[model samples]
Target: MSTASAHAPAASVAPPPPGPRTEPLLGNMRALRRAPLDYFLAQVREHGDVVRFWLGPKPVTLVAHPDGVRHVLQDNVRNYNKQTRGFAVVRELLGQGLLTSEGDFWLRQRRLAQPAFHRQRLASFASTMVEAAEELATRLDARCAPGAAFDVAEEFNHLTLSVTSRTLFGSDIGASVSRDIGEALARVQAFANARLTQLLPLPRALPLPSHLRMRRDLDMLDRVVRELIERRRADTGTHHDLLAMLMEARDEDTQERMSDTQLRDEVMTLMVAGHETTASALSWTMVLLSRHPDVRRRLETELAQVLQGRSPTVEDLPKLALTRRIIDESMRLFPPAWISSRAALQDDVIGGYHIPAGSFVLVSPWVTHRHPRLWENPEGFDPDRFLPELERERSRFTYFPFGGGPRQCIGNQFSLMEMVLVLATLVSRLRLDLAPGHPFVPAPAITLRPRPGVWMTASRPRAATPASGTGQ
Candidate 1:
């Protein structure tokens, strides 16, 4: 499964028959630019689950079938490497953190980080989630101001950012810093995907405008992370935070704790992935709720009936089944991690299509989750689609917001708890309704964000009863 074997010069790693080609060098770039998702979907319609094309000059393969996705993510994982488009920028900001590092380095980092997210341990973080949600509720309650409208997306982004900052570094990300980081992150992601440099292959040190801005953004984040690390190092008292747990973690084999640089990378990795994606998910949830009144009302009714009137805890999650269903549906419509890309290390056949070594393979949750053949009313938002009874009849890859297999988001459980608690707490207290005729379009960035922001109105629920809300 080694890359050497996959790309062995002596071996014929290319598919038995390579994918069809278009006119000379134009490739499939123009078609993709016109309508990327539809273009890929059309390929699946014509050529079946596996389709190969060029993104400008680079060769890429798109897989749509469940087995095809599983083969790339699990069985033949070692025959693939992270693709350049996404990882290159991620590596620039995070360095050798779990997301970008490969081989033993990533393995060691994952081992050290996994304990903090263990089932028993994550229970302690529920209170933290509730506390963050309470603050969010308080902010929104104060903002209601009798018939005033607010950007639900912005509000949720702030809420998730608060949770992420407090949970990861035990810091309150102020408005200015949050706005700065958010804007910078957006710019960096946009610039990376623009493929401006694919035509030039500029070095990291190049002094281009985009590069300079990205560097400045990285410097700002680095400064903040280093300061957090220094403060944590200075504290001698025992703290039950992720940072403390990471600091205490040791490699079983090497018995070496993480160094400051390693700590910085890990912290930044969590901050970036933790906040941005969660925020987008929450935002989209609100948008979906606005669009689907019945679902939102049922969610509120469940919160009222189940909790009476209290924040959720770990034990309460199973009972909050409907709320979880709403969140799941939102994710299916707009998964935070929209697309995952990897380069084939060895030529492999997926869905009867031959993929050559070094070719980039894209398994997009956005594309597959909404595939016409795989989903009923694929473009519609419906929570019942995730009901265990119904899901049992569907293909595994038909719904993978957090992905599947080992490479799935390690923070999946934690994130789910966070989202459920936040939603339950907020919806139990406030009624969110979408602005009439407001256009809510999907903007597929690092996460699927609402293009115009989720605009909605918030009103308090008319009830006063003692109810405990816990994470199940």
Candidate 2:
């Protein structure tokens, strides 16, 4: 036996984690459905980091502490698999793509896709990102006249969709196609989130109204993706986009290429993941910036100093520290992947709480990022908290907006770079102010999106303006 295995400590059994007051069988289902974010926050505050509740007969545990999160995501990662309720909904849409696959298949896909996201390769896409942002800025300039109200969330959705299409597939989805794909993706995610909250979800084949709608939306998306894949395959020219690279990727051991179905699944996964999450992040960031003008001033000042009225390049990223921090802080307050779940493949113990085999373990970046014990002013919008010095004092898992461990987001760097460039380019030209009476609130579906959308007015920044005095 290996020395590590020989000396490993034996597992010890412990009682389930403490939970809120519950009724027989039903448990916290009602509360979880009504307001999941508040429910999770309250549970962690009252029941400690590890909290347990029942979804009917099934047991669900929420792990909110950094150490416990580490134990589940890293230390004992092998014992946990993505076979939980949350992933089941994702699997229905994503199939065996990297986001929902497991075991060796996931590893091979990860390896094959890793090279496409290399720093050098991603650097080449910086211009594409900036160009997309510029195109949006020009359109917004024309449509959003001074003091004119518009839905920033909707605009961001379009901007991110265009960027993702160009970067991922080397094609523009255009205005009409972008809108169609955006609407279809929204319906699919809504259906999936509904399934996630149900104690006994109806099967997809049941032909319920919701199920039928989901089927239609899924079919619409599949058709669009399949068409894109077919066009890529038929093209003769060499293309550098992610789709082309993925099409050409071959396994080292077997020397095999991906099948058409595999390519379609991956394209769909990247299309959804690459755009939707980034759009959500940008939408929230714009809302926060509008509400916190002082933070906006700082961000604008940094952009001025770094870019001097020119478009930002990949080389300018290091100098745009505050821009990156704003995105980081925005994600902390409203993570794109707000919640994650893993089912235990073997019995385990985390933070002295027993996790039985087949038990579902939940981790919420929304809760952990705002944990009272972890942050001094957990709910405040303070980008400086992510500055290097303060960031080092916290656990790595404490602010996992992109998740952690081996399965951490493959597009993390790509997303970060994209956000920075887009924010810098747009904020340099126009300042987005919240529209009157918009009533913006977070709708934590599959992704944490803004409910009713974030309505805001865009106008050119006033030259040599004083700080707004809302400094962090």
Candidate 3:
């Protein structure tokens, strides 16, 4: 047996991952644009975990298995870079911030931003999240009649925008400011998505309508960010907000600080990343909770027992296991950062398939989270799957809502803490039910947003006491 194994023929080279026929030059671009989420889901389901496709002349590989995802995101992360078309579009808005930067520069920025998101620092921001949720509850109470429908998506967007603004910049972003930023981000995201999907996008310098508008929106974002930075600089007292921390941070090796341009990029990155994604997650959670009454009941019970009608603090987080699980499951189902792409910096093998250099590697949480082999009842909504024991049995890459490895989201802890506090505060006080006849559709853009926005009816919780006041 040993002699036979030693002389065994070499393993056969596996053929490339299967894919559907593509038009010569168009190359599946139409299918991608028609329904990106559905298209990707079908690719993985029909073609197995590692599927290959083309975008015109460019090669795109969809990695749907956890092991393969680990290979790209963690094990050989250096061989993959964020120089993909998707990130290029993001950079048009974010500049050379941590989200878009690569190499040694990204390392320096990550280190500088790391301390501000330390557990201790995030603990202090709980009050801000609770306060924002309380204000939202009060506003919803006044605007939404009992059993009458309103846009929960809009409300969550406003609430999270408020929370992120106060926590990151130490200033209240009022309705007007939030509206300005929101509109600008929407425009930028739309343009970016168009550019990402287009086989050959128009040049930005062409003065085309979309390009012109994107530039204008980008300028608006810059103005707001610079204004915030200027305001922080003019203030006399030291603040503990993220902006202050970033401003004071210095490279231990070089003793250099981030310039104003760098500051603007980082601040804008925080605002966009911190606000929009959390709001999308919360909105989806609310929708899921309303649809799954049993889960919602359990969540309400957990909130009541842990919060006791008081605001949730950072200390209360671990105890609110169900709340965290609900958020996790919601993100699993409808992750805001649903799909992320990386460009291969060098040729490598992932899951036994050859990946050529400069190829686009797609790691979609949307597809992997529902992979049949990894998840029992893959389409079902069950938060208990995230119970510690069960979660420990799963692969780390199976449920990466905040992504995995070093390039993972920087403010993940901050987002989770904020969601927990805000969800606890609001759910304890109000019962949100999806409005009758309102369709639930996921809009896959740069971030996942509800297409027409989630419409819901807000009412006082049946078991809760009358509100004496809002927030702690």
Which segments of model 3 are wrong by more than 4 Å? 1-14, 144-147, 464-472
Predictions in order: lDDT = 0.77, 0.86, 0.84
TM-score winner among the candidates?
2
Per-residue lDDT tens digits of candidate 1, residues 209-290? Answer: 8788878888887887888889889998878878998999999998999999999998877777887788889888887786
Report the Cα RMSD per candidate: 4.2, 3.3, 4.3
Clashing pairs in 2: none
What CA RMSD would candidate 1 show?
Answer: 4.2
| Candidate 1, run of 10 with poorest lDDT | 1-10
- Evaluated at residue 218, the lDDT of candidate 1 is 80
Q: Which clashing pairs does model 3 show?
A: none
- What TM value does model 2 have? 0.95
Candidate 3, poorest ten consecutive residues by summed lDDT = 1-10
The best candidate in terms of lDDT: 2
Report the number of clashing residue pairs per model. Answer: 11, 0, 0
lDDT at residue 5 of model 2 (Cα atoms): 31
